[model samples]
Target: MPVVLLLDIDDVLVLPVGYKRGIPATLETFTRRLGWEIPLPTEADIEWFEAAGVTSEWDSTAICLAGLLLEAARLDERWIVPDFDEAMDRLAARALDGAQIRPDYVAWVKQAGEATRLGERPSQAALRLWQREVLPQLPRSEALAALLSALLATTHSLSCPTTAVFQTWMVGSRAYEEAYGRPAPVEVPQGLLEQDQPLLTRDGARALTAVWYEGRLAPAFYTSRPSRPPLKEPPPPLPVYSPEAELAARLVRLEDWPPVGLGRLFWLAEAVGLHENPTKPHLIHGMAAFAAAIASVDGIIEIQALQSAYETLQAGELKGPLAEWAEFPWHVVLVEDSVKGILGVFRTVRRLYELGMSVRLTVFGIAPHPGPKAEALEAYVDRLVPSVNDAIEEIVHLCREG
Candidate 1:
């Protein structure tokens, strides 16, 4: 059997400068709206959050904004400021170290339930902690509560203000309105999405393509980015602003491959009532990526049928082509820049092994620097490389030797 490769999008194949820059922009938009300016998070601060297992930029934006509100409330409770806005003003006045923000925010998250630690629905966990701890200490003020509510609100669509603002930063104002059916509060002619640069080198692309064509490697993508709904027919033209795996694939000339993204998960939620997080380090996402990769190899071109195959795998009935995958010895290489993706695939591979499937696992972490992300990756991944190019080059060489 060919080596099955599962790749992550952000900080893996692409630099994702868009998302990295958008985090602080999202924070600034929210804080300015609340009538005070505080120190925005730096890139290192963002890395700290990712290393701590809060991978989704949406959740990161929410947590940072919520922490700001929590700080304001904390100051008000201590009589340091007369009002929330004044408290924010006081905070803005101090040269607060951005590095301290992650620790304080993480402390609040640590107080939440067990799911809070491993990139599980952390925004929701932070909300519960706030309602239980901070909400009670302050005098009842509807406006303040409403601001916090907007910060923590969840929605299937882009109705949540924080999500809406982040989308605007990502896709621009015009495209944002078209996708979500509402005018963006912020207006920019061009989106940061266009600014994202591909990280894969030419040699890496050629090596990957050669192995893929030589029947030595099977590959697919798994990511949390919202995507177009899976359809039985060929996917439609890219929307004005869709940062889906399809977009990433196009950047690397691998658009023919399949990716199991959040859009597919949203469709599953509506069709089968599968309400699991459906993102790494969650098992459902790992299984879905596995199914989609196999489907690509089996010529299962219909998106709906690929989803059905995933359901069959979940049911543990390997009656059809899924059984064929189990019969062959397979090497599964999960390539990711974050620990969550590696862990998710590890869990999925273990589940497959329990079902008597013949599969071996290798986790490759794309960590270029000695930061918190690299440190976290140390715990989960088998090898740490600087980029996907380097990882793919090594994998290709291994296939040649074998």
Candidate 2:
């Protein structure tokens, strides 16, 4: 068994007072972040902040990530205080935080209610319907909480070892909301609720998966969001399944993993080899095979391995024979919206290889030409060709420098 500390950054640990949508700190917020406010970025603020050179999320993520690691180590503050760089560089997921429910999942859930009154406006309709539709999806039934405990345990173990993910806010209630755009039907205890803790926050703290730090898995953190204002301003923390409650959830799903909307999964299957009628009864057969093929990447499951597994699934899902993976020079392809100008880069690729200077990544584009010239790859490089060739050379130069 393993325990993992999942930390979120938006409203749990830091936030800006009047941050505008799509804009980074207004110079004022920027200054305070370095000193006082831990600085939580709104969903839109990440990109805006990234470009403005706010400390890399990785850097800040490391410090917070170490908190749980410290508690787990039993060595406490001093041990974690020194390993900031390694933790920042290694402990955290690059972009694994926040939550947004898929719209389609809710649509399916709500369809069951005939003429159900949700609301008139789109926002209100969705919220009201989710209350009716999504609440039933996770009702506490026979052993539901217990099964959740095991899954949470497994997830905790996997989070650090296989693409370590400490979601700044991967709350169960959040997952409830992520799946249905609303909180879980469960209520917060009166004591926790009285302190002004959000039901989501109160619920998530309970949901953290527990782990034994006897070096069973690599050292990892397991804790809840500290309620202090500065440390608690980021996003809410993800919940863990208390061991008992978790086991209950597994039993709840025992009949099967409740079918997930697999449009993306379906699309991945088609691309990978999932067919309606296939020689194989199942597209995937094992967790390892499935994990090898599909993994949580950048906070989303990438089904590449699941598809790759299809090639091997015939006898058993083995990494397909090398011939299947062998990369050949791709055909000169002109895709939709393509102009004739792409050929210039193709020519440059051919030329560079001939010159014994093959590019690792080939690129070309039209430059802001002073004027036009003979349409040719050489003409572009020579600056004697039209905007197309000139663009190619400039593009090539930028690519090389980049």
Candidate 3:
């Protein structure tokens, strides 16, 4: 089985340890060290973690293979697959004890558990108990095991695999009461959810509270309070490429200039080619990046400069609301073959956006129809989506500047 590597706290490093201090006072320590908080596990769900050689210090769940990543040498954190009985040897393990739980999160789960019933409220008393009692007593190793076991029993998400974890709070008190009949289960500590509770997954689920824990934890507060103001004194721009990064600094010069022309265009395409091509199929997708890079290259004014500009465009900076457009209820993602013919998608997206139909496109590179008239987009998807003939031409048309 391909095991999933989801963590409880997305950020699993110690903030204080870096400054030669102990753990940081708040969740900042967790975020500073680990990047994001995965999900909290209950006492019963620990077996899964132990099976994977993960130990939870009061503040972190350490992984054996993370040492390599910490040392900047490797990223293979999985249980290695052995070849023909070569029993996979364990990689380096790290300590996960002697840390502290993020303070605020500890309180929230606890409140939810105690306010509700053991098995009566959303998360119940059991999970809270685990959070309050068992976690403190158990050594890092034991706490991790118990917590993983408790969490896995009711919270393991089969749908959101990979680093993605789906969790909820105060889900289905009556349902929980029916299933567990206790505020907290015996095996779980004080605040861990008891068995027989509704495990929240997607945001749409009624009984569950959906959460997205990617690198930054702020999505949890996306609709909440205003974010910290932009730094009054903006941080100075740092060089994007390191002196020893191996690539020529010329490649990193796109921050100020618009890349233009054939030579610059090819490099742009090549850069994207490097980013997308884990396999052969990506070479084609990379073309979009190539085209955009050409358009972005400095000192450009003609169609020819397109290739260079396409190569220079930074993707994330342009990728915002594009994802939102992708979620249009009526829109469906269909591959159009006719869109190809060397730079066709660029024009295609351009036309679609011109016509006012939001198109979620990612040919040669990802592009979206900025916004479109409803009828036109619906008609286009029906008539133009899913073609094998014009892949390049269509994508080139589809991805062009609006």
Candidate 4:
């Protein structure tokens, strides 16, 4: 089959370098629209925000916005008293007393701690106020839609079968449900490309494919509730590689890879190692292969569990059932930016190894000048390029080598 190219959206397709700048503008928009005067975040605040983003602590910008709103409300400390302090202190006491804390309570304490670390203390009252008054009043979904729309407006849009998979801790929160309508399920939009006009705007069409409230796919702290199901069986070992002729014949049968592209096609094809692609119809097929690969484990649908299976395969504890998923693509390409994305890519690489497939992994750093974390990914990925364009060039070079 044609190489399955997996791409990440955040920094890879859409550079979030403007996020720092967007925060102030977003805050201003919120203020003007809501008639609330929220102070703009300073440079130091932006720094902390970005740092927190790298650490995957929270939705830094969202939290920052919440903080600004809390400050704007200027609610009386009386509101902050019993509920905030009492609840927090109760949790603290429970921890000290060796009492098991409720998951919701633990989440609240973590948020409070993060707020404290960020030099903002959001009393439970402030949170309640925001949920009741501010969050609902704000155009949360519209703002997100606008942001994604703006990004797509600037980039080369995908014409092929494409899906957008979003993972946000906020989606699982009651606040999110209260703010937006119930989260959307996994589905493609009808009439997305109708009469040469997309029914929903490009972003809206993509949004239809979004799968949210599945926090098990993201970092642990992001979700308040555990979504992973228990594992049932051990995963099977990797399968032996298909013959070269068999692999080439499979690619010839795929209609998605056009003849023109195939004419210029190098021996290797690109495939993306994605964390989530709930909207992609082929996702079920891939997940089936993944499930077969890890038959012993339950919850293979969860990204975290899928990653653990990949690790087991890597350690040689698991063997290949390559014959089972012989149609799995080879010479794939994967691109990632976030910590979660990188981890997903790592697992994909191991999976490929188990299948006797080769991969060309590209780490498009968050910025032109990435930090140690991005650099550290070099140990795992096959290549580290500055941008997606560079990654394509690298793929071409690899093809020529073969």
- The 10 consecutive residues of candidate 4 with the worst lDDT sum are 156-165
Error of 3 at 19 (Å): 54
Local distance difference test values of all predictions, in order: 0.69, 0.24, 0.24, 0.31
Model 4 C-alpha lDDT versus the unseen true structure: 0.31
Tens-digit lDDT track for model 1 on 133-208?
6777766444456556555656223545566778789888987777666678798788887888888877777788
Clashes of each: 0, 56, 124, 24
Q: Please provide, for model 4 over 1-402, each residue's C-alpha lDDT reduced to its tens digit, 9 standing for 90 to 100.
A: 223334443344433333334445443433344444435555445433333222221233334444532332232222222232242233233222111111122233235334432212223222433455544544442332232222222111111000011111212223223323343222223211111211113342222122112111111111101111122332111011101112221222221111111111111111124322211111222222233223322223333333433334435443233333344444444555444445544555555566565444444333334554455455556566665455554434433342
Candidate 3 runs further than 4 Å off: 1-310, 315-402
Model 2 per-residue lDDT tens digits across residues 130-245? 34443245333123222222222222222321102222122233443443334443321221111121112222222221111121111111011111111113323222221211
Against the true structure, whose lDDT is highest? 1
- Backbone collision tally, model 4: 24
> Ten residues in a row with the worst lDDT in model 3?
217-226
Best-to-worst ranking by TM-score: 1, 4, 2, 3
- Displacement of the residue 258 alpha carbon in candidate 1, Å: 1.2
Candidate 2, position 248, lDDT: 19
Q: What tens-digit string does per-residue lDDT give for candidate 3 at 44-109?
A: 222222112121222122111111122211133232222211111222232222132222333433
Say which prediction, candidate 1 or candidate 3, comes out ahead on TM-score. Answer: 1
Ranking by lDDT: 1, 4, 2, 3
